[model samples]
Target: MLIIATYDVCTTTAAGRKRLRRVAKVCESIGQRVQHSVFECTVTDMQFEELERKLLAEIDQTKDNLRFYRITEPVDLRVKQYGCFRAIDFNAPLIV
Candidate 1:
């Protein structure tokens, strides 16, 4: 299934900054970064479970937030970019 994952980790302290980087890295491993804190991931059931576990371990329950929206229905995603908005096609074949 396709998942839209987003997170916000407090960066006011050193620990928070570290947590933010860790969280981002986890997401990056399973998905592509659409924004600084947003990612689009296509994961299986087992992979999704592991992703959640890793993210939970890196976040502060009281200070950080994470959200995952499962995209089950088809919807239109349009962009109106003036510059530097290089959108990635998650469904396209990756050319190395």
Candidate 2:
């Protein structure tokens, strides 16, 4: 399955991107940040749960927020139509 995660730093700061990177890494090769703070992950239900937990752990409720949408398959096409991410292969190595 695929999950589209969109997030924002309510109070922008250098720490925001750092925290976001930490969270993004937890998803392993299944996740990638398409925009500054938004991410997309493709994984099984179990992996997705792990990713969500990791993201929540890194977030500062006082300073950051996220929204997630899940879809099974065809995630690349969906992203292309929305003009957000270029078609991405989630199986690729982590960009970090």
CA-lDDT, candidates in order = 0.86, 0.70
Pick the TM-score winner.
1
Residue range 1-37, candidate 2, lDDT tens digits: 7788776654467888787676566543567766665
The 10-residue segment of model 1 with minimum total lDDT is 73-82
Best by lDDT: 1
Write model 1 residue lDDT over 19-91, tens digit each, in one string.
9989988999999887889888888999999999999999998999999998774524432335676657777
Provide TM-scores for the models: 0.82, 0.64
* Sliding window of 10 residues with minimal summed lDDT for model 2: 76-85
